[model samples]
Target chain A: DQQVKQNSPSLSVQEGRISILNCDYTNSMFDYFLWYKKYPAEGPTFLISISSIKDKNEDGRFTVFLNKSAKHLSLHIVPSQPGDSAVYFCAASARVVTGANNLFFGTGTRLTVIP
Target chain B: EAGVTQFPSHSVIEKGQTVTLRCDPISGHDNLYWYRRVMGKEIKFLLHFVKESKQDESGMPNNRFLAERTGGTYSTLKVQPAELEDSGVYFCASSPGTSGAGEQYFGPGTRLTVT
Candidate 1:
């Protein structure tokens, strides 16, 4: 079963607008969530993250909101630029063992920004 | 410092062949992880290593797959008699902290094609 899911396969946004990508999880044990951006030929790059303790976390133009009660999270990029276009993946992690954590990733959402 | 790196960016081989994918985490980072994305599926965790030890390997698919971190600096994932279903992109990631809270850095990924 897919514990974490990104229902939207793709999204397009005009430049200078806000781009929101959504994700949901079925596992309640997941306490940490992360967002990663990936270009076609490169590995995923960490974007932002939020702990279950906080409802929101922001860095520069990227912001992540978590609704633990709803088992959902979303990533928002304000003034989205052309360079922001890429495949975005949502991942979650819990303390499965001591001194290490494994990540469970979603299918990913492809975001395209138009000029 | 350099980011995580993977060798043999792309590999194509027939079924029943043996293949080994390697990953070199950033210097001084003791945590290493292996993950893969089969076609039409979400990225899934394979295993995790902490300083040359297997901390969590519950994600490994089966006995056909083997992972090793001999010297604690790099890791290798070998699939003997690879099957067609094994064709996918394999990713490696590393983190510096002991907590599950640390952000993991990813490599470019190795694309394995089983014909």
Candidate 2:
């Protein structure tokens, strides 16, 4: 079963507009969420994250909002640029009983920002 | 100050072959993880290591896969008698802290093709 899901397989937005990507999780035990952006043939880079304790987190042009009651989270990039076009993945993890960590990821959403 | 590094960017072999993928984490980082993405599927976690010991390997698919970390600095994943289903991009990630709350740095994945 897919615990994390990204319903949209692809998205397109105009430059300078806001691009929103959504994700949902079926497991209620997940308390931390993260977003990663990946370019072709490259590894994913961390973009932003939100803890279950907070509803939102922002950094530069990226913002992530979490709704625990709905088990959903969204990543918003304002003033999206062509460079922002890539595959975006949403991930979540629960606290480890030991000292290590494991992440569950969603099927990525391919975002295209038109110039 | 380097990110995670993976060796053998791409490999192609016939079925029943043995393949090993390596990962070098950032210096001083104590957490290591392995993930894989098959065709048209979400990236899935394979395992996690803290220091020199495996902390969680619940995601390992079968007995054909083996993972090890030596000296707590680097790791190697070996797939013996690889099957067609093992074709995918394998990624390695590391974090400095012991908690799932820390941000993970990823390496360029190694793409393996089993014919």
Interface RMSD of each: 1.3, 1.3
Q: Candidate 1: where are CA atoms >4 Å away?
A: A96-100
Per model, kept true contacts as a fraction are 0.88, 0.84
TM-score of chain B of 2: 0.96
What pairs collide in candidate 2?
none
lDDT of 1: 0.92
- Clash pairs, candidate 1, are none
Tens digits of per-residue lDDT for model 2, A1-115 = 9999999999999999999999999988887889999999999999988888999999999999999999999999998999999999999887633333588899999999999
Docking class of 1: high
Candidate 1 TM-score for chain A: 0.96
Q: Among all windows of ten consecutive residues in candidate 2 chain A, which has the lowest summed lDDT?
A: A94-103
